[model samples]
Target: MKEAENRACEVMLHAGLLPQLATMETIAAAAGPVLEPFVQYLLRHISTPRGVDGVSPFELNAALANALIEGEEALTGLVSLAVSIVPLAPAAATTNSSSLTAATSGGVCSVSSLTRVRLTLHPAYPLNLIATDSFLNLHTMLWTLSLQLQWVAQSLIAARVCLWKESQSQKRSGTDNNTTFSTTTAPSTRAVQQEMLHLVHAVRQHMLTHVENTSVRMRRGIATCGSLREMQKQCGEYEEELRHGCLLHDTSSSQLGSRKWHNHNDGPAASASGSPELHSSLLEVLESSLRHCILLGHARQAKILINKAKQAQLEAEDAEQEALALDSLEFAKQKFSQITCAVAATEREFEGHRVAFMERVSVYGSEAGAHSDAARALLAAVDIQGRWQPQKGT
Candidate 1:
């Protein structure tokens, strides 16, 4: 077992995936105490120098940097998948008390425990020997992935909490009738909504930070283009017009200033006219940025809906508990109206973003057919909002 573990560590080190291996160790630690030894072994392996004799430190570091980048891409894909599937799972399940208890308690403990471990163990990769720009990019990706994982973990926790509460409610009610189940489920729904609101707020903050970092990197890339060679390197191609303009300048100093000024004026235009791969990549980044913004908006809307639903549930419960003069039917009508208003408001907000998202895709779609198709597919996968129905007795 020790030999196998060492061999695995050796492969990870040679592939420049020590950081990723560390991350996996952190994730695996969630499975329980059984994996503690494995995690410790990984920690020791990475910290100890097991040199690849022929490879220079610079080369190894470069490979590690590339691995960081690739891992980021993989994490982004996972986040996209998680977001797409978030609403597909039923928020609450109706089952026998025994089955529900077994499912919720057992499942929640294992999944949430593991995910929580990952959330806690995400480390700040050391930057002592790394280039500033590369480190910044690497850190941004790491932060984004960490946040995405946190969101997924929190979502799972919320589901688990809701399920556990439902199981408890089922046991308390001790009846299989629909009316009893619905009545008992109301409080749990409110509880779940509360947890979801907190999770969504955290996710929105992280997403905003991610978007800011990405924008800063994009701006930096555009601002640093200073010559034909630099422009070609950055933008991936130079037009004949730009090449001729470069030749027209008299002195090296003037040419340098001219190139900077010209690039500043025409950076977007140059990117538009650059190689297809370069243009597509830029568009993909923009699309991803916009998608994150849309996600933030969606999260905010979800919180609002949950708040409204909770408020309605509370009002209904209060009306029942108090033998007030106010008619229950009238109170129910008022609460339902408030929920409808909230839903309408959410729909309006989502529609605005949907329009903006579609406009972006349409503008870029003509330029990059394949990317636009993929973007459209992603857009299709996003749920505007689930259909709202008033719970019985509310």
Candidate 2:
């Protein structure tokens, strides 16, 4: 039963059914009853390596960084099949009528246990499904992260290609036929610029798609928690507030600047209180606000990306650990097979042995034969080897 529960837990974690423990307290709260000693171990490991001040930006970033790193490792461990504990079915009372049914069920159970754990990449929730809001939010964050990575990769590729082309162009221009193709440079520059623009445009489209998908996933997560509606209300209110503030600031700046421009025609524009000066101030304020908005958007997006990368890293680590475990299991099986073969060989060599020897040979071929074979082989080689020669002389 314990083994079965552990297998179920592993399956849940790998399937992402188990929510990530974001805090040590949360981890304890969720898993303490089920895994007391393990939870305690986790708590000890999770204790603050260094104190962090919540109000300090540096400390907050550092804490988040550490959480993400550890979270990634944990996620990876979960994903790999190495974490699975295949639960054995209990033996049933056998009767002639049930025998065939039991046999079939046993086969089915074996097949099921052998099935690999698969990850289901869910789509973002529908815009209407408030039920999945949290999942949608998480999905959105991952999508944003993927987009950022893709954008960076594309930018690097584009830059390298552009540089290579420029170098080639310079080399060609320096050659004998240079003047003949000089006119091509203008068109080439235009083409290169267009390509770069296209790449940027494509990246933006990809990001938009990712956002939509993530939004769906977040909605699903929210729905699972029965908080989708609440999340939707909060998000709507937040968006409304952001839009209202932005519009109001924009309007105020435009109004103030226009008035100052009109007033400047009548007075000396250069004076501190004049329209020209006030206009400059107004423009600065507008620009500053816009910059602030942009920064906020960027920060939000960056946070999402970080979260997504952390998830991906976790999945990767799980895969690695699972592979290692499978390798270990295979290694053990091979060692067992080698021992079995050796035991069989030794038994064949002593086919005419007495009851004790026959028992030893039987043990070497039994389910737990590896150790028995080693023991028997050691004893026979050491104590019984010379004595057996007398039988041959007789």
lDDT values, one for every candidate: 0.31, 0.31
lDDT of 2 by residue, 231-286 (tens): 45644543322212111111222233333221212323222112223223323222
Candidate 2, run of 10 with poorest lDDT: 110-119
Off by over 4 Å in 1: 1-128, 131-142, 145-333, 368-394
lDDT of 1 at 367: 49
User: Which runs in model 2 stand beyond 4 Å of their true positions?
Assistant: 1-73, 77-173, 177-183, 186-202, 205-224, 227-394
Instruction: Write one digit per residue (lDDT tens) for candidate 1, span 125-172.
Output: 221111133323233223323333343344445444644565576678
Model 2 TM-score?
Answer: 0.21
Give the C-alpha miss distance for residue 332 in model 2, angstroms: 60
